[model samples]
Target: MQHIRALSAAKETRLTISVITFDLDNTLWDVEPPLIKAEYAQQQWLLQHRPGAVDAFDHEALLAFKTSVWRRHPALAHHVSDMRTQMLYELQIAGGYSEEESRSGAKEAFEAFLVERHKVVLYEDALDVLKRLAQRYILGALTNGNADIYKTDAAEYFEFAFSAESIGTSKPHPAMFKAALQKTGMTAKQIIHVGDDPDHDVQGARDIGMHTVWVNAQRKPWPSGNKPDREIVNLRQLPEAINHIADAR
Candidate 1:
C-alpha cells in the first residue's frame, strides 16, 4: 500500500470514468480448459509426426521440461508464445530433426495450440457487464497472456488490448501500467483497472495511482493486505460496484 495514493476525484468522475482496463484470462473467461486442450493437441501432433515423442515425453515430463525452460530463460518470460515455440523447436531439434524441420514443426505445433487457446468460453455474466461498461467508459484490455481479441471475437468491446508481449513487459510491472496511461491519455487517477489477480491487477494498478476493483470471481480472500477500492463476487456486480466507486469520488 506504500505505492498507493489518495483517489482524488477528476472532473470526469461526475459522469463516465475516463477508462476501464480489464484483465483477460480468468477475469472474462476460464483459461485452463482451452490451454489443456491445446497442449493435448500439441502432444497428439508430436505423437503422429515424430517417432518417439509420445513415449519420451509424456504429460508429466513435458510439463517439467516446460517449467525448466521457463526457469532457465528469464528474459523470455514476458513473451510466453515465443517461449512455447522455442521450447518445442528446441525439443524437436534435440530429437534429431534438422533446423528447418524443427522450426517448421514447432511453428505449426504452436499454431495448433493457439487455435484451441483462443476458443475461450466467457463466463455467463462477463459479456453483459463488459457491454454495459463499454457504453459509458473507454474499455481496454491489459493481460500477461497472449489471447488475441480478434481470435476470441472480443475486438468489438475493447478500444485496444495490450499483453506482456505487446507491452514488452508483464503485469505487476510499472511499464505495463505506464503504457496504459500513455495510450489512453489519462492519468491513473482517472481510471479503474479491474482484474482477478491481487498482485498483478490490484497491486500494480494501485501502485501507479489508479483505483482498482478486485474481481474475486473465485471467492478468494485478500491475502496481500492491500485492499482494492471495490470487490465483487462476479462481473454481474461490476456495473453497480463501479457506480459506487464513481459516486464515492
Candidate 2:
C-alpha cells in the first residue's frame, strides 16, 4: 500500500490537476437498458411503418444486423446517427423496399429509435459521485456515443463534454485524448480518466500520460500488460480515488 501511495504521488506531481474527463456510457449508467429499448423501438417501427417489408424483424434480428454492420464499418459504430442511418438502409434493402420508400421509412424509424434511447436511467450512485467529485475537479465527459451530455441534464456538473463525433476520432486513438487535453488547457498528466473500457478509457488515457480509474462494476478481469492506476467496483469509491490523485499534486 505504501508503494502504491508513492507511485500515485509521483504520478500526480507530473502535471497540475484541474479537469477530469469521464466516459459516459457504462461508466455513468448501465447502457444495456437504453440500448435494448432503442432496438425494441426500432423493431416496432419497422413492423408498423414498413409493414410487409419486414415480417420477422425482432430484437435478436436487429442485434445480428447491427453486429454485421459494425463488423463491416467499425468506425461507424461510434456515431449513433451514422449507425442509425446504416441500420435503416440495411433494413430497407433486406426487406426489399424501393429506394425511396426505404429512405422514408428509415428516417421515421431512426427518429423513433432516438426518442427511446434518451430514457437512460443512470446508476444508483452516479450523480452522487459526480457531485462530490465536481466540488474539487473540473468535470467533463469523453464519450464515443452520440448523446449530448449537455442535453442529459448532467451538463451542469461537467465543465464541458466531448465525443468522437466532435473530436473526429474515437478512443484508443491518441488524437481524442489530445483533444481533451487541449480543450481543458491541461497537460496529459493533469487529468485522471475514469471509464469502463480497458482499451478505450484506461489504456488510451494511460498511453497519453493521464492516470486512470477502471470502474469494474461487472467485476471484469483486468487485461494483462495494460492496467489502470486504480480500480473500483462502484462509483461510491470514486471520490477517494480523486482525492488520492489530488493529494499527489
Candidate 3:
C-alpha cells in the first residue's frame, strides 16, 4: 500500500499495462512437493536400472553432490534441465556403468523424473484467474525453473513462456525480461511482472521500469528496501491489484 500510494502521488498520467508476465514456481503452484516427488521417481529409476547409482549416498550427500556438480560446471548453471541430466550421467558412471550405458541410462532416468515433474497441482483458483486475465492482457510466463508450462493446466492461457534454461540466464537477470519486451514489442511501463520472489520478480522488473505485483501468499514480511508496486495474498486478488495500478494513474 505504501508503494502504491507513492506511485499515485508521483504519477503525472495514467498508465496502460498490456502484458502481465509471471514467475512459474511458487507463484502458480507449490513447486517443492512436485519436485520432491519427481526426485524420488528419478532415484527409484536409478536404483532399479543402474544399481548402486544412488545407494552410496543419502539425501544430504546426494544434495551435496548435486551442488558440487553445479560448481564444476558454471556455464551450465543456467540450464537446470541439462545440469540434471549431467548429474544423472555422472552418477551412473560413479555407480560403475560404462560411458555409453551411463549416457542412455541418464536420459531414461531423467525422462522418469520429468514425467512426474509435469504432475504439478496449481494453486486454488489459479487457472480461473489466468483465464479471466488472458481476456484483457497478453499473458506471459517468465520462470527461472525448468517447469514446462505447456504441459501444465495453465498452458493455453499463456501467450508466451520463457525460462532460465531457454533464455540462458535466471531471473534478477535482465535477459528474460528483455526477451519478453522483444517478443511483445511492449514498453516496460506497459507491462506488469508478478511472482512470489521479491528479488527475482519485483526487483528485476522494477529495475527495468516495469510495474510489479508481488504475490505474497505466505504473508511474509517485505525482506528488501525496494518494494513492489502492489502485493497480494493470492491469485484471487490479482485483478484488483492490477486494476489499482491502472486506476492509480
Tell me, by lDDT, which candidate is best: 3
Kindly list the per-residue Cα lDDT of model 3 for residues 98-154, writing each as its tens digit.
Answer: 999999998999999998888989999999999999877888999998898899999
Local distance difference test, each candidate: 0.82, 0.79, 0.89
How much lDDT does candidate 3 score?
0.89
**Over the stretch 1-249, how does candidate 1's per-residue lDDT look in tens digits?**
111112123333534366789988988888999999998888788767765644477679878877888888899999999999988887887688889988988998888888888999888878778887776677888999988765665667787788999878998998888887777666887789999999999999999988899988779889976899999888899988888888887
Give the runs in model 1 whose Cα sits over 4 Å from its true position: 1-16
What candidate 3 gets wrong by more than 4 Å, as runs, is 1-14
The clash count for each model shown is: 0, 0, 0
Consecutive 10-residue window with the lowest summed lDDT within model 3: 1-10
Clashes of 2: 0
TM-score of candidate 3 on Cα atoms, chains taken together:
0.93
Ten contiguous residues minimizing lDDT sum, candidate 1: 1-10
Cα error of candidate 3 at position 232, Å: 0.7
Ranked candidates, highest TM-score first = 3, 1, 2
Of candidates 3 and 1, the better by lDDT: 3
